[model samples]
Target: MILTAPVSMFAMLMTYSSNGSSSRPWVTPLVLFSLPLLFASLALRRAIPALKRSPQGSGDRSAAAVALCLGGLVYALALGPALDNVGVL
Candidate 1:
């Protein structure tokens, strides 16, 4: 999870930074997407024992991670359109 989070963050940052001379509409979505994963990761780290003890906890965490990834993709898609209209892309 740690590895995945950093990679995902890096990808988002790269995408954000790569948009030259304009803002990406999807930036909000990307930020929104990353915020949850960041919080979840922190929560999981702080509650490692609880997560380990719960039989279904791992699945829950995986689901949350997947959701975050989907959010990022959605953001990426929306970003272009958003930027096109707002003159930021």
Candidate 2:
């Protein structure tokens, strides 16, 4: 779940970068690729509390936090660009 977020973010970044000259081309790919990222974020959100409750999961907790923040930042960065790319903003 944690790993999938970055992978999806990379896919989105690559697609958005290489999508020159295409019209309304990003909607489909964005919808398709965003699913994994969304799922990863949801899964990580659920896991964080569980990780905090377990003594052995201290490392896992930090890893999840980092992954969550990374995913969130990517989402934040993508928002304006995506809206601009789609001409919706």
Best by TM-score: 2
Query: What are the runs in model 2 whose C-alpha is more than 4 Å off?
Result: 1-32, 35-39, 55-57, 87-89
Query: Using alpha carbons, what is the TM-score of model 2?
Result: 0.44
C-alpha lDDT of all candidate models, in order: 0.54, 0.63
Candidate 2, 5-66: lDDT as tens digits: 66655555655546455545455445544765676678667767856785775777777677
Best by lDDT: 2
- Clashing residue pairs for model 2: none
TM of each candidate vs. truth: 0.35, 0.44
Model 2 lDDT on a 0 to 1 scale = 0.63
Error at 10, model 1, angstroms = 38
